[model samples]
Target: MEKLLISACLAGEKVRYNGQALPISEPLEEQLSSYFELVRCCPEVASGMPIPRASAEIIDGPASLVLEQKAKVKDNQGHDVTDAFVRGANMALQLCLSNNIRFALLAEGSPSCGSFLVYDGTFSGVKMQGRGVTAELLTQHGITVFNVNTIQEFIDQLPLVICNQSFINADFMK
Candidate 1:
């Protein structure tokens, strides 16, 4: 089975900044594991950040700017956490490279793992179309990132399979 790097929080690990896990349904988890080996990671935790850490968001610009050191990540308590965020992203990239992981399923709206959209640095619950620090770095290194809402797209790209007498093939739709 192919190895798929997944956000630890999505894999039922309590690694979120709130010390919570956002796991998918049991059946879906089982199905995905049947097809791919899940390699879980929490960039923040890997970077030595504690659980229940302060919530943070990229400030002033997108994740690209954060990677470029042109922007910052500030926690809800108004502390600059850009260094931690960047460190976590680099750690995530190292994990991908070492594991030969080509794909990732990250938690959306996370400062470290959001694949498509992240909180807009306001702490007001506003989200913007952008990748998070880790997501942006992984993508730059050629890793395909997916969120819960788009996992089906990844499944659709898989090779044809016959399971329990049912044909699972995206090519048939084409």
Candidate 2:
């Protein structure tokens, strides 16, 4: 079976910044398990962040800028945590490379794992159009990334990919 990288919280791991887990519905979980081996990760925790830590967001600019070292990620408490976010992203990339994983299902709106959108650094519940640190890095490396809301799309594409024994390009899916 092909492998799929996933956010730990989505798999019932209590590793979120608020120390909460957002496990998917049991039926959906079973459906995913039937298709691929899930490799779970909590990038923030893996980067040595404590559970119940203050929420962080990409500050100064978008995550792309952060990846380029021109921006930063800061917690709500006004502490810089850019390095930890980037480190966790690198760890996620390495895990995908070593595991031959081509797909990721990460938490949306997270500073580390959000694939489609992330908080806008104001801590006022605003979101911006952009990828998070890990999502941007993984997509750059040719991995297909999906967030919780887009799992159905991933499932829809799985048959074509598995039957052809090749990874489907993100473009083709779009």
Supply every candidate's count of residue pairs whose N, Cα or C atoms clash at under 3 angstroms.
Answer: 0, 0
Worst 10 residues of 1 by lDDT: 165-174
lDDT of 2 by residue, 76-157 (tens): 8899999999999999999999999988999998988999998888899999888899999999998889887888877877
Error of 1 at 37 (Å): 0.9
Badly placed stretches (over 4 Å) of model 2 are: 164-174
Question: What residue pairs clash in candidate 2, if any at all?
Answer: none
Question: All predictions: root-mean-square deviation over Cα?
Answer: 3.9, 2.1
- Off-target runs (Cα >4 Å) in candidate 1 are 161-174
* CA lDDT scores, all candidates in order: 0.88, 0.88
Q: Write the per-residue lDDT of candidate 1 for residues 1-174, one digit (tens) a residue.
A: 567899999999998888999998788788778777899999999998999898999999999999999999999999999999999999999988998787789999998999889999899999999999999999999888989899876675554553443334334334
How much is the lDDT of residue 24 in candidate 1?
A: 82
Q: Global CA lDDT of candidate 2, please? A: 0.88
